[model samples]
Target: MTNLMETLVENREMVQPNHANMLDTAHGGNVMKWMDEVGAMSAMLFSGETCVTARVNQMNFERPIRVGDTAYITAYVYDSGTSSVKVRLITEREDLRTREREKTTESYFVYVAIDEHKEPTTVPDLTVSSEEADRLRREALEGENGNC
Candidate 1:
């Protein structure tokens, strides 16, 4: 088993013009790509196997990250079942000068472990130690149930 915290991953991306939409804000696809890469990294770290995205739950863009802001992303493997690993991903926009941050996006994704033959493989169970990881897991569950 892998501890939830052990599988946690974080990344920061600059919202350059190339990654922004006409509104001078980060594009939805670019945000999703960043989240997907971090989520896959977390899943691979926990599963000890190659992982591929199987499904993405509802994603809500609470706000936009303007160009020149920083896209701060956090992802962790919070649950697993057989070959599947569940990850919670959140993105925040950090001010370029003030250093302030605000949540901009949130979503959950499921990944399937694969073996050399590109076949689905079993994944290890997920474990948590009642730290921030535990709290995030609870939040993800509640969010999934439309209670967050």
Candidate 2:
């Protein structure tokens, strides 16, 4: 069994000009790509194998991230099937000077573990070891605040 807590991943990227949109905010595609990468990291950790994105269930961007701000991303394994790992991803806009962060986006992605031949493979069972992990799993399952 793999503990959900062990598969958690956090990443941060400073928004650059190339990653910005017309309004000088982070582009929606850039943000989604970042979230997908983080989600894949979590899935790979949980599966102990290379994983490929199979689906993105829901992705909602609630706020814009300015070019100077940082995109702080977090992801964790919330559930799994024999060959698929389900991850919850969250993105926050972090103002470095003010040292403040605000939730900007939330999403759920499904990844399939792949073998050396690029065929789908089984993943170990998942478990939540702590109260916080349990809460996160519950929230993901419940689709609380429409973040699913």
**What is the C-alpha lDDT profile of model 1 across 37-143, one tens digit per residue?**
99999999999999999999988899999999999999988789999998889999998699899999998999999999999999988888877878988887887
Report model 1's TM-score to 2 decimal places. Answer: 0.95
Candidate 2 C-alpha error for residue 37, in Å: 0.7
Per-residue lDDT value at 127 in model 1? 84
Model 2 residue runs over 4 Å out of place are 144-147
| Backbone clash pairs in model 1 (N, Cα, C under 3 Å; residues 3+ apart or in different chains), count | 0
Q: Deviation in angstroms for 55 in model 1?
A: 0.4
In terms of lDDT, the poorest run of 10 residues in model 1 is: 139-148
lDDT of 1: 0.91
> How do all models score by TM-score?
0.95, 0.95
Total clashing pairs for each candidate: 0, 0
Question: Using TM-score as the measure, which candidate wins?
Answer: 2
